[model samples]
Target: MKIARYEHNGFPHVGIVNHGKVNSLPDGTDVLETLNLPLDAQYRLQASAGRHHRVPLEDVRFLPPIEPRAMRDFVAFEAHITGMKKAEPGDGSVPEAWYEAPAFLFMNPWSLTAPGADIPMPPLTKALDYEVEVAAIVGTAARDVTPEQAREHIVGYAIFNDWSARDIQGREMQVGLGPSKGKDFANTLGPWITTPDELEKFRLADGRLDLEMSVTINGVQTGSDRLSNLSWTFEELVSHASRDAWVGAGDVLATGTCASGSLAELWGRAGRQDPPPLTVGDVISITVQGLGTLTNRISPQTSTGVPVPPAWSRRQPKESP
Candidate 1:
């Protein structure tokens, strides 16, 4: 089942998409209330529930499908890792343990915007970049989950754009923080969350997760890759995150970006040229196979200049009276 949140007449809401119309629901934003509902259940509820209504597809705005109880974005794509290594060889690919260890970095929830919304260019940031990623939403709680049981916990998948500030990220990593500053600002997620049952109907030609994807900037394709190339599986990531942590419903887990989804394309193989970064009004679109496209516009942040000190400071401490 496809679960969605949309906005109409400036008020946000939850809905189900069927035959091109968005049927609105009158419930709190509790995703579990209707997420992953089978088509039969959905139809039954629409007919029986007086709170349900439908809106024309062209009139509503889409929001991220799930309000995750917790968000954990993992770096499981090898191509992104290797590309970053080649882009900045000094950085080097993560240690082998990282493959087995399955690490994740936290992203700012305040930065989240809808699929078609305009994203703001951060103040004083010139090295703005995008990463294409896939994320899974958990449907049930699982601690110390095994790979075989991981699939049951997954509710669905969606496309994510991990907008980054490379300069701030590099500085923070040196302090062993792992993307506290560089990774904040903007994280785009939307289109819709595809339930596990829907995904089960499709598989890569090689029977893997290698889905075709691309990232375009200003109507130009900048990078492209496949999900099949991931170094680790989604199960491994789930297992890793589940250890000592309570995996609960609405938890979002991001599978890292693939090879071509790095900033090196705009930068260089070694060191990039001076200040190859995003300016206001740049549009970025991240597309994943089956999942719809997530498009966002980058605009300059509104600034009010630096503030001046109070008159008391200008007058000095008055001889420490």
Candidate 2:
């Protein structure tokens, strides 16, 4: 089932999508609460939705289906890393330790931007980029779960764009502890959510989906890849996520970018000048076969205030008494 959250008449409502229309649930329905419900309960919501109002899809504004309680992203695709390696001839082949297990990083839940919103370029970055990925939303709380059990907790999937400031990220990561300052500024997670049931047709024997994912920059196609090609499945990602920690309902996890999912990856292959970095006013459209498309436009940079206070101590190295 395709579940969605949208703004209508100045209020947000959760509903099911059918035939290019959204049948909103009665007012006051909480998106996360509805998604976390048991299958029977959620089905009931879908059943009763039709009795309310079935608004044409275009009439309403789309919102992020749910506000993630927490967010985590993983590097689950081999091609993405492999392509990055190809970018730098002597950067050393994809680090050997990468094969041991998947790598993930916590993302800021507060930074999520809705579909059609103008994404402001963080002033600290000149090389802004977008990562086209697929993210899973946790349906129920769990801990220490295995891959087999992780499936039970995952309720749905959505198109994810993990926006990045390559220049800032590169500097921060070199210190072995960052990505937060660079990433916390913004993230886009809208369009809508698609339940696993609606995507079973694309599922493979190995648990990955056979969906085609692609990205375009200002009306020109830039990259494309198949979802089924990931080295690790979403199940693995969820399982690894719950290894020793708690993952609660409404939390979201993303399978990092696909092979050609980002221009940075392209820059890694060729020179940065060829494809170049994302500039202000560039429109990026990411589309996954069944999940639909998410489009966002880059706008001029904005500064709210001074970035931060002084880092060093107030006293000088050897000040006179």
Candidate No. with top lDDT:
2
Scanning candidate 2 in windows of ten residues, the lowest lDDT window is 303-312
Can you write out model 1's per-residue Cα lDDT over 18-106, one digit (the tens) per residue? 66777776767456656646657766755643255688767788876666657788888765776576555465655677666777876
The clash numbers for all candidates, in the given order, read: 3, 1
The lDDT of each candidate is 0.73, 0.86
Candidate 2 on 1-321: residue-level lDDT in tens? 678888889988888887899997877777766766777887787778867789988888888888987999898888898877765547647898889898989999999998878898788777889999999999888799999999999989999999998887877877778586777888888688888888999999999999999999999999999999988889898998898899988899999999899887888878664577888999999999999889999998886635676466767574569
The runs of at least 3 residues in candidate 2 whose Cα sits more than 4 Å from the true structure, single-residue gaps closed, are 38-44, 87-90, 305-321
Give candidate 1's error at residue 202 in angstroms: 2.5
In TM-score terms, candidate 1 sits at 0.84
Q: In candidate 2, which residue pairs clash?
A: 87-268
Model 2 per-residue lDDT at 146: 93
